[model samples]
Target: MEALDFAAESLDAIWSEGAIYNIGFERGVSEWRRFIKPDGILAVSELTWLTERRPADLDTHWREHYVEVDTASAKLALLERQGYAPLGYFVLPRRCWLDGYYRPLQQRFAAFLQAHGNSPAAEAIVEERRHEIELYERYGQYFGYGFYIARKCHYG
Candidate 1:
């Protein structure tokens, strides 16, 4: 995907949510750093390991799905390495999974299946999602969307 080539040292901050992985955590933070003014903030939410150790299945799942998935400390260190000073961090709440995303998505499954003609492919996709939700429900303590907020350490 094409990245926006913003004017250097023009922005006060850059915020990204659940999307930076489209390019990659390191690449996104590094490339975007040049656009921020002195001490400007860079905030992003990324798939992160809540703990260094996790169950084999959960570990395997994330590794397979997002190879860049790592602990929050690692993410923060990566930010620091990219010239950002850590300011704050938090995991997206459980409701962000249940009440916000999965519940709403589950509500659409039937219609989605219907629209897709209930084909095996569509069903398989739904099943995979269900499996993911189940895994989260069981091992949420090990992984989640980690919100990282930091400021640029370099001045223009």
Candidate 2:
């Protein structure tokens, strides 16, 4: 994989859309800040845990991605240091499990095959569905995903 200079390109893209605000949730909040104007709005969907637990298979993916998965507290602390403030946080851990994500997609793909018949496109869809199931089964050991919201503090 090649790394593009995302920040440089983002800074260079000049366009007007009236009070532009950058919004991204999950995983790359640190990098997303670089693309926004210092005084511009930063709004994001965020996830927080009112409670914590030892997630299953954390070590495998953690080593693979080299991500220091921060708790909600640590994420807020890091945002504060960067002059961003937490705006809102909520925990809506799906009461269901990975089957919730997987089963629907599987059903959709099967329906697609029935509708489309055995074309190459249909076969590709089947393959993709199989891959998704394998990936979710392997990696989605944890039963929930969290959401978060934050804003860039106005310093002026």
Candidate 3:
């Protein structure tokens, strides 16, 4: 069965961390809103611009990779438009990336590279991950993951 086969308004809460970006933030919110009970909550974490004026290089990189990335206010506006009442939101700390994700990934990538030294595909994948980490190190101050918490409006 497809994903939507689940009954509507059957869930008390819906939480989507990093995965929502895969479906596009606006679309994800719009689609998932139907699955929640009127008073249910939706908590999502998405990439957001932290500063009003971003450096050109960082802006260019995200525009190329994730064109939909926007400021937290913009995301809140979208939530409001989609019938969600904002409760609270916070920017994830840098440690969430460096400590929780990238560092462990770097260790794994190093092991994978050693095990597959002969594979060009493996090298390319490692290189891409390295580049992402490097970009985060340099431009982390301008943007980050934002956790948004909201309650579904009764009318929606």
Candidate 4:
């Protein structure tokens, strides 16, 4: 995938997995326009700030690493300008079962972090995982990652 020069031409569709939060919705939409076919779709899962009110304890680690994001309305507007419109939006809340999903390798991840603690990259990994766990355990709400299915519009 690294060898492909996608920007040189448009793609049939762009699946933006776990990227909207990383790049923020605006940039992600712009990037999709640059590489996606005019009639294609852009699908993404992202943490949306639906309201302007900021959470008092926004995860520090996440904020530092991922740019602070905006509401779905703001994102919709941005996407519209890029010739795309939202088709659907949905959310999947965190549950105790999710912990089971990670339990198998939780210890392994911890051990890896311990062994690589002194490195910058390791620190980032540790901080992110720790904050996710904390949010799930204490607030019963991990990241509210949202999915937006958008399709490029045609203009005469």
Top candidate by lDDT: 1
Instruction: Return whichever of 1 and 4 wins on TM-score.
Output: 1
TM-score of each: 0.92, 0.46, 0.92, 0.71
Superposition error at 42 for model 1 (Å):
0.5
Model 2 Cα lDDT, one tens digit per residue, 37-145: 5544444433232335544454444334334444567666766777667675554444333455557767788678888887898988789668646644654543224
1 or 3, which is superior by lDDT? 1
**lDDT against the true structure, each candidate:** 0.92, 0.50, 0.90, 0.65
Q: RMSD in angstroms, candidate 2?
A: 8.1
Evaluated with TM-score, which candidate comes out highest? 1
State in Å the error of residue 143, model 4. 4.7
Root-mean-square deviation of candidate 3: 2.0
Error of 3 at 149 (Å): 0.5
Q: Which consecutive 10 residues in model 4 have the weakest lDDT in total? A: 95-104
Displacement of residue 32 (Cα, Å) in model 4 is 2.0
lDDT of 4 by residue, 55-112 (tens): 4676554566566455567667777887897797776455432555345446667678
User: What residue runs in model 1 are displaced by over 4 Å at the alpha carbon?
Assistant: none
Question: Candidate 2: what lDDT?
Answer: 0.50
Question: With candidate 1 superimposed using the best TM-score fit, by how many Å does residue 153's alpha carbon deviate from the native?
Answer: 1.5
For candidate 4, the per-residue lDDT at 96 reads: 30
The 10-residue segment with the lowest total lDDT in model 1 = 1-10
Kindly provide the TM-score of model 4 when superposed on the true structure, using C-alpha atoms: 0.71
